[model samples]
Target: MSYLIKPAGYQALLDLQQTEMGIKRIKDFFQQNLSSELKLRRVTAPLFVLKGMGINDDLNGVERAVNFPIKDMQDASAEIVHSLAKWKRLTLADYYINEGYGIYTDMNAIRADEELGNLHSLYVDQWDWERVMTPKDRNVEFLKKVVNRIYSAMVRTEYLVYEAFPVITPVLPEEITFLHAEELLQRYPGLTAKEREDSAAKEFGAVFIIGIGCKLSSGEPHDGRAPDYDDWITETENGYRGLNGDLIVWNPVLQRSVELSSMGIRVDREALLEQLRISGQESRQELYFHKRLLAGELPQSIGGGIGQSRLCMFYLRKGHIGEIQAAIWPQEMRLEAEKNGMPLI
Candidate 1:
């Protein structure tokens, strides 16, 4: 069953009409700020890729993709993209993007297997971005630097949103704290991974928990990340591991941690092989995308997806993701949201 959290004395900060305007404003403002800060150029991305091409994100290696046969082409099937993690890397090479430069796209996807809840939705919309980088740049310091840039963009966008919609106060901290997953595990040994995230976010206001996807000292990953994209198994010069992580914040509306992005440095050939072996997904090395990576055909890059609607929901202090995006919801959830005066778009 999906979980729900209803904050006490919660109400819509902006009415439906105003919320519509606020969504557009936030999207515009954030994208501009992000592109400027990251040296990214906006680009067009595909909604679906041909099946058997191994282009779709196999999120957790379990969630199924929405696929169908193309009538005009015999034996050809197209699958709706879950995210552009792998595709973006190929695009960098195709566009001949140089190091320090990249591209960002407004990506819309369908997660058919997603469970319904205040934070979870079947429809996913995010700013998917990728940037080329030199081998020397693939380190924890570079990852943290890029993360701080993104965080700065978010803080700037928050101020802009608050100025336009005064009722929606800003709750984000001026600077976000960084914590490693293993440290969090040590700090809260009795808590589950999600519970640890909640404790850290509540205490720090905003945090970036590093070292995801790889098994911690406890013999389980702090969170699940796809093996192909993030180089989670590699350790840095300081003995810290994982080149990727999630940006989590304390959401007052839900009284829980809200993850706004999942990103990391794209895996190189060695890291990819190691991660595949560790995740027991070595068979994927035969897939078209995986083969190209193994052959060193794709560019070295860092990339991630920032949820557009989730950011709006958090910045606007909405109770649910559906309030900022048009998406299907369960009847019971709709009724519950209505009873709580929470608007779902």
Candidate 2:
């Protein structure tokens, strides 16, 4: 069964028509701003890729992906992309995307195993981006520099929405705070992972939690990260072990922390092999993409996905994600959202 969240006395700030307009504006303005800030080019992305090539993101590594047989190719199966995490890196090499430049695309996918809720949906849409980089740019400082630029774009988009609608005031802070996962654990020793994020996001207004996949002093990872794409195993100057993290903010409507993006410096040859063995996914080395990386054929880069619906929902101040995008929902969840006055598109 799917889950439901009914925020107390929640109301959408924009009407259906206004919400649609705001979504378009956010999508257009943010992509343009992102491209300018990051020196990226827009590229067309794929809906599905041939199976068994290890090109798709595993997210937390256990969610099932939707796959079907291709009739024209004698029933060869293809899997809908989870995200273009690895594909973007390969593209950077193929297109000869110069150093310090990147690419972005409209990424859509089916997260069939997603537990439907106010935020989670079976239909996933996001902006997948990647850029070529040098080994010197693989540290924490460089990662934060990129994140701040993205956060700045988000703040700009928030103001743009307010310009169109007076009622939706800009709520994003001028600057976002950063903390490592270990630091957060030290502050809130008793809370679960989500609870810790909620506390930090609520207090800071906007935050970026670092070292996400590394095993902390508590002998557990603050959260799970797929082993292949993000370089979550490397030690940093601060002794933290991740070059990736999520940008989170407190959503007034839902009264919960909302994750806007998850990105990191892509893993290099050494980091990739180490992470694979640690996750017990060493068999991936034989895959086409893995072989290329292991053989040093792919370029070094940083990449990530920014959720389209999530961003729209945040800027539009919608109580539920359904107010932003159309996607499959369980009957029970639909009834609950309607009763709570959240009309699903």
All candidates: TM-score: 0.98, 0.99
Which digits, one per residue and each the tens of the lDDT, describe model 1 over residues 153-258? 9999999988998877888899999888998999988999999999999999999999888788898999888899989989878676799999999998889999
RMSD of each: 1.0, 0.8
Candidate 2 lDDT for residue 176: 94
Model 2 lDDT per residue over 29-132, tens place: 99999999999999999999999998988889998889999999999999998888998988998999999999999999999888888888889999999999
- Candidate 1 local lDDT, residue 118: 90
Candidate 2 lDDT score relative to the true structure: 0.92
Which predicted model would earn the best lDDT?
2
Residue pairs in clash, model 2: none
Clashing residue pairs in all predictions, respectively, total: 0, 0
What lDDT score goes with residue 273 in model 2?
Answer: 96
